[model samples]
Target: MQLSRFTDYTLRVLFYVAMNNDRLSTLNEIADFYGISVEHLRKVVHALAKSGYLKTFRGKHGGIRLNRTPEDINVGAVVLQAEGAEPLIDCSGLDCTLSGVCNLQRALADAQRAFMQELNRHSLADMLDNTAMKQRLIGKAV
Candidate 1:
């Protein structure tokens, strides 16, 4: 299953912030680094701050920093928060007669649960543990 762009952006924002934990990062900087739109990043940043993943500062020298340590940020939890409680598939709209008899929904749900469980085993800090990879991606000498 493919994730929504919103969820994708949320994860990217988290990764970038986690990698630059040494200092506050600006939206423009991250936007330029990833070649993504600053406007879109603004929305993602706002949601992240509201969810307590980030602390946002206003005014001239304003920027954002992670509110919690990278080790405290769970990938699964973030995915859950970003995706909300929406079902992966809406079987109600289907015209198929096997909707009630089919076990596809159950199988999909189980797979989704397993996917989240695997992600839960890793944290943002674990993502940055690969120094060479982190440096290569974010251009930071972490």
Candidate 2:
């Protein structure tokens, strides 16, 4: 299953912040680095800050930073928070006759559970461990 652009951007923002944990990061810098729109990143950053994943500072020298340590941020938890608990497939609206008896929904549910369980095993720290990769992407000395 494909994740929404919102989820993707949320993860990207977290990764960038974790990589540049040495200092606060600005929306323009992050947006330019990833070649994404500042408007979209602004919304993602606002949501992240509201969710306590990030802390924002206002004014001329304002910027954003992670509120919690990288190790404390669970990848699975982030995905769940961004995507919510919505079903992969909404069978309620489907008019198929096998909706009641089909095992497809159950199988998909199980797979999704497994997917999240796997992600739960990793954290932002794990992602940040690839220092070279992070450096290349964010151009940070860290």
Candidate 3:
């Protein structure tokens, strides 16, 4: 199942913040790095803070940081919350005669379960463990 843009942005914010855990990261900086709208990131950051995943500070030197450690933040938990409760495939919207008997939906559901299970095996830190990826994503030598 493909993740929504909102979820993608949520993960991006988490990744960038976790990488820069030594200091606070501003929304404008993250937006500039990812080439995404700062307005959109404002919403994302607000939600993340509300969800207890991030802590935000306001004022002249205000920015954001992870409220919890990188290892404490589960990748699957983040995705599940960001993705919401919507089903991967909305077969109810279509007018198919085999809707009741189709195994495709079940198969897809199982696949999604497996996908999340794999993601559950890793944490935010796991994704940033690669030296090259860390350097590239943080855009600095580490």
Task: State the C-alpha lDDT per candidate.
Answer: 0.86, 0.89, 0.88
Point out the worst 10-residue segment of candidate 1 by lDDT: 133-142
Model 1: per-residue Cα lDDT over 62-84, one tens digit each: 88989999999998899889888
Error of 1 at 122 (Å): 1.1
User: Each model's TM-score, in the order given?
Assistant: 0.91, 0.93, 0.90
lDDT of 2: 0.89
Residue 9 local lDDT, model 2:
97
Worst 10 residues of 2 by lDDT: 133-142
Instruction: State the displacement of the C-alpha of residue 91, model 1, in Å, after optimal TM-score superposition.
Output: 1.5
TM-score of 2: 0.93
Error of 1 at 69 (Å): 0.3
Q: Write the per-residue lDDT of candidate 3 for residues 1-142, one digit (tens) a residue.
A: 4788888999999988988878889998899888899999999999999999999999998999999998999999998888875667779879999978999888888888899899999998898889987886778412
> What ranges in model 3 sit over 4 Å off?
92-95, 140-142
Question: RMSD per prediction, one decimal?
Answer: 2.0, 1.7, 2.1
What stretches of model 2 exceed 4 Å from their correct place? 138-142
Residue 54 lDDT, candidate 3, scale 0-100: 99
lDDT against true structure, model 3: 0.88
- Tell me the tens digit of each residue's lDDT in model 2 across 21-77: 778899998888888999999999999999999999999988999999999999999
